[model samples]
Target: MNLEPMAGFLTFWAWWVAALVLAAVETVAPGAFMLWLGIAAGLTGFVTLATGLGWEGQLAVFAILAIVSVLWGRKWAKRHQGSGPSSVSRRADQLPGRAVVLVEPILHGTGRAELDDTVWLVTGPDAPAGTVMRIVRTEGATLIVEHIG
Candidate 1:
């Protein structure tokens, strides 16, 4: 079968299939790399259908698009690093600055306190019962605290 006349159709279909496969992989594994490549492949398939490029040219276009997409993704990731908290996600890190009465005196830098009905292992200077302290930060499962007065 002479595929010469049908070259454009074949190339477009091949890239379309590749794009779908890559997109599915990205959806399942979610490494962020495959999504860009899938987008590139989809664009390449469109370009091949419109321009009727030969195999070599189609491959080149796909490769170039893949590289460009990957580079753009990296640049975007770097720019958005640690931007802010998401509304959909939980905010366990927002406990700092919340005032809580020390349930037990902090001795040798370790004690216990109750916050929001949860008992937390606290670390700070020694104080007697009923001393108020502010949460400084959390270290692992322990809450670091400081005396308020």
Candidate 2:
């Protein structure tokens, strides 16, 4: 109920302490949300130390900084969204142009081929078992191949 004592206890250093707490929270449960708030608090501490702003002004500055940092972070994330390394989990995408030996004879434009530890359904011209084929493309779970020799 009494605010005078609490208001006297809040200093510029209190903002810096709040920033550190927010940063620790960000590390434990991260999605960049608390990170921006921490940054805002850190900047507010610096501004408070330099300008000696009242509590009202400090709150205003922190609110503005938090909004700006979050919006900027979102825009930055969107711009870099497609610039990461290509996914290696899609085994089919990496199969094209690679050669594989047919494990089952192709009788009607379909057969099975072994590559690595997996057997893949293949579709192409008729080929005997043990014949080598190069993957040209993929159709769903099937590999489309062409004769290698």
Candidate 3:
């Protein structure tokens, strides 16, 4: 068998090069989807080098790996996906469900509050300074404060 050509890939090096390039692009892209193809390509490269496979077999491996990788990634994400600000990697964790005192006295208008020495943009009805307020919700870095009246 002529080892110089494996389908469109010229020897195993072609697949190797393609896999490497895809892996690098995956880093720049930073997603599980592309990583799958990169891995599959790398695997195909090694397989090409290790064994003599026809184009049909190579294509079969590629398709199987792609489908499996994507499905695995999706399931992994689904199992790990979370709800609320707890999963969020930010300071938003310190705001939700916390008690705050009206520093500027919100009276039927917007105002701000400080919790744990952190200032948060708030929206609520009229209230005076020193009134106890609770953070009901958070919206895009803003806190939805409600007067505990």
10 residues in a row with least lDDT, candidate 2? 3-12
- Please write out the lDDT profile of model 3 over residues 1-149, one tens digit for every residue: 97455544564677778778887888888556777787787788778767767677887887888788778877877778743345446666556778987777785668878877777677888787777899988888778888675
Steric overlap count per candidate: 0, 0, 3
Off by over 4 Å in 2: 1-10, 78-86
Global fold similarity of model 3 (TM-score): 0.64
Residue 106 alpha-carbon offset, candidate 2, angstroms: 2.9
Best by TM-score: 1
Per-candidate TM-score against the hidden true structure? 0.78, 0.72, 0.64
**lDDT for position 146 in model 1:** 92
Ranking by TM-score: 1, 2, 3
1-149: candidate 2 lDDT, tens digit per residue: 98654453466679989999999999998677888898899989888877778889999999999999999978887787655455765667888999989999887999999999789999999999999999999988899999986
Residue 16 deviation, candidate 2, in Å?
A: 2.2
State the C-alpha lDDT per candidate.
0.86, 0.87, 0.75
Give the root-mean-square deviation of each candidate in angstroms: 3.5, 4.3, 4.5
